[model samples]
Target: MRSLAPQREETAMHDHRTLGRELDLFDTDPLIGSGLPYWLPDGATVRHTLEEYVRDVERRAGYHHVYSPVLGKRELYEISGHWTHYSDDMFPPMDVGSDQVVLRPSLCPHHALIFRARPRSHRDLPLRIAELGGMYRSELSGVLGGLTRVRSIHLNDAHVFCTPDQVADEATAALDLIRRAHTAMGITPVRHRLSLPAPGGKYVDDPDLWRRSTALLTEVLDRSGLPYETAEGEAAFYGPKIDVQIADRAGRQTTLSTVQVDLHQPQRFDLHHIGPDGARHRPVMIHRSIIGSVERAVAHLIEQHGGAFPAWLAPTQIAVLPVTPDQHDHARALVRRCADLGLRAHLSDARRGTLGARIRQARLVPYQAVLGAREVGDDHLALRLRDGRRLDPAPADQVLAHVKDLVGAHRTDLW
Candidate 1:
């Protein structure tokens, strides 16, 4: 049996409140109410960078981007069966005089509407549609955390509509895309959880479909030779799923992503395509999210790196410091050079304090500081690494090149 004592002890040691405040990432505003986050400028930068990364990956994986309204008609939820099954998680319906609408708690129903918009044929069988949608869920106040649990969430939702014959191939492709994304984000040793419904539980009423779907997912995992564990009673009401878990610094496991094999939604929505025999047939739906939620993933990255972000993800990758007021112009020039090279940089003038004090301040903020000075009767600068090592700066072009290379390499250790 798993002990809850260790979980309580671990929670005490890693206080998210202190980390969130110290890092200036996110904060709860009383005026905004609980479960809502007001991301500071630094936190916003990290969030946007992560979104861009995911968008690029989705585009390369052949997903067509789409946008849906945050509020949907009450009838849509009824058709999707969310009104009956997951209604507790949704916001109360608002009566718009003639019609009732509720804040969206998930993107699946909206994506289904997109599929119903047109008459799809077998040629468009494997239709991949993705959306970075803002969804709302009314959480109990006690469950709210910085970014881990929230009232509003941005999800990287992708739905693959494939014919029954192509379902396995599409599932494999989705898994490949997720693997590539984990690699890009430096999430190592990815673990999978084959989640199924508990026996005689709130699963879809078809026992045969559940058995076949679970077996298919198991075969995929086995063929890939990836280590996984069976998780009973963790599946969605619609179907079984594969949960991707990652460990943090404290060794606490969290679900970072998921790929669910949904066999009910497509049929409920009557999604169909023309088959080779010219007969109408139901298509399979595969729901994949490489990063579970934008806000939650950012929180995980924060704790994983302890707020010292990698070069590519850092808000300020480099800080320029002038040795004296006389070198202020040189420092500003370096900042511009870095900016031109697509690196986030800041200039620290020496008038505020002594050179050593300014360097210490830069270090406190955890940025790579460059100290500009006069050396050997020539204008020169010293590159101060995050580890306190100082190196003679080369030409401006050479410095920019090196910084670009470092960022490209995603070097977390070098500074």
Candidate 2:
């Protein structure tokens, strides 16, 4: 906790855009068009790890993962009200003979179709569907910067369909998941926002629907006892939302996670589940994102940690730098041991630079094992932690156990 202020200062000095280029994490090619950045091998490794973490969390929380199309029929968006409320942010429709398809701007419409694919009963109430999906938004080039504001997004998105009576509980649970995800990634939300529609804002026309959904989320926030501020014109077009806000390097607040209570979408799609009494009833749709977009989340993470990510999240967790050519075989053997222990370890280029320079070069790595001629066996390999602490040579089994425990537990400590 004491390191928070200093770390944020470090983040401000180490903007992700600059680090991305220097670290070879990700980049934008002019041929790929603006607002679309390609992830390098290292960047993809981090993104894949984050996605895996999100999947594990969602699964434990009773959400079933799904894969949906990135393109949807034009009528699909129209039926979901996106055509009317959000078409401006969406790409132009692509014509295919008599029909047209558009790049999806959100996952809910497809998830909604999944819910309606087969008749569901009350037993299936609170059906939670999750996806690490790709979507696109047509942003003006000027507004696009790095990964934070991109056209292509791989989102950590989920939807919960439950009875109206269960909305509050589901929303609370969703908030908990979001908090856990943030903490795992070393992010702290500076504030929580209850986003509502503004005067004459483009929202669902039904007064009762808006009122009910807003009160539901407001009560959940109040019951959770987390202080929040209400923001006008900051909500989704279909409903009000509780946004988890974090400040970026420039100290500008951006929403990273959100839980939105929606009544309009289910109604628009005419979605329903059969009650225990055999009557058709509307199921409330609660849309939530733990870490909204992979690109934006990684952007925040890179800046927040200054690319010195916590042990579990570091793309290359450890670098094995052999001090001399004589120790080359020893270094290769140690890297294999690390791989066997599930650590991402790479042998640094001992051929290119001096040993001291190589150690300094891998500063972003969470751990470094520098094996020299004197350090003959795997059992006596010394460690240099990222925070500049040096560990004396210890038994290889004991050392690997401790390091593996920390990484496996997703901990920050490197002892």
Candidate 3:
């Protein structure tokens, strides 16, 4: 029995499929193909909430949101150096008359074209563009997990174009944004890694530029007081990058976000802006993603919270259960009140199962459940918090007010 205890505990902690089934969050259908997710209704709500959060954050940071097509002409990749450098990661190109089209693996080149849509001056330097864009990559079929690795990803992608003088400041500001996002989501602080190119490898082939870029990134980390590991030769072909890694409950580290400085892309794309001296000069590019992808972030959140989402982010903030058929009307009214207060709530009919069974089911998925009943002549609701605390019978308005505060305050874990 003692030896069996450890195995049972391990099974309880690492069982993601159990959480997925219990919460009715997501599932994959064979008919839909592998590496694809069929998001259940509740799962879609969670995804949308994350998207809104990122979009709002980006807007406040002075980033102009833009939309680009999922497919691009083959020639675009040719000029962007992706064809030669990252061909293995891209999806197969499609023949459309004389032009070949391929699904966009990244948004940099498309955003560059947007920058060139019109002429720009030094005033337009430090232009930040953001996109909650969907991209496709031909990932190896065997490596695909639920949401961690997917063929289609709605990336919280952004790029900043700025002058040489503004590089450090822009990088710092981007880091600040990412920190705020992680803090809000209750994600653990991540270890930063400074990713540089390997010596004598397929880097940008400019040693001076690599050294300068690495120095700038190192300075930013120092000024921010962020502890980081420097990985030699791990940089992208175009620039040095900062990879933010977070540890899961099992202590496996995964990259939650990244910020990269690119000095090569602007030159490759011939991107330039009018300088203060009225001359066309190249602009540097910085690419960043706070959460990386909506799907993967959702998966991480589930694992982090052990499938018990915070009130604000939960698909169903509160579940109302009636103790008897006589209390069904009161429970329904309570659900309506929750909805009016902008909380997601539902009423579970008492006829379905025993009170203990219903409570156990709700608690297993781990949502906050309320039990309404009539002990005396008047009506009241009992609050069962996710953390196992039970509140005395309270009036509907009082109950609604408390739940509203909990959700608004983002107190999902505490309750």
TM-score of 3: 0.91
lDDT of each prediction vs. the true structure?
0.78, 0.90, 0.81
Predicted candidate 1, C-alpha RMSD: 3.4
lDDT of 1 by residue, 13-102 (tens): 444555666778778889998888888888888888778878888898889999999999999888887887788888999999999999
lDDT of 3 by residue, 1-415 (tens): 4577775677467545556656778888889877787788888888887788788888988999999999999899888878877788899999999999999989999999998888989998799999999998889999988888888888999999998889889899989988888877878755899998887766667778888778878888888899899888778887899988887665677777889988777878899999989899999889999998887788888777777776678787787777788877767776787788988886777899988887776763334445543522455556777778877777767767877776666544544
Q: Model 1's lDDT to the true fold?
A: 0.78
- Model 2, residue 251: C-alpha shift (Å): 1.1
TM-scores for the candidates: 0.90, 0.96, 0.91
* Candidate 2 lDDT tens digits, 1-415: 4658886667646888888878889999999999999999889889988899899999999999999999999999999999998999999999998999999999999999999999999999899999999999999988999889999999999999999889989999999998888877889999999999998877878889989999999999998999999999999999999999999866889999999999999998999999989899999999999999999999999888888988888888889888878778877888888899988899986797999999989998988988876676544768899899999898766787788998888776676
Evaluate model 3: give its lDDT. Answer: 0.81
RMSD of each: 3.4, 3.0, 2.7
In angstroms, the error of model 2 at 257 is 0.1
> Which is better, 2 or 3, measured by lDDT?
2
Q: Any residue pairs clashing in model 2, and if so which?
A: none
Q: Which stretches of candidate 2 lie above 4 Å from their native place?
A: 1-12
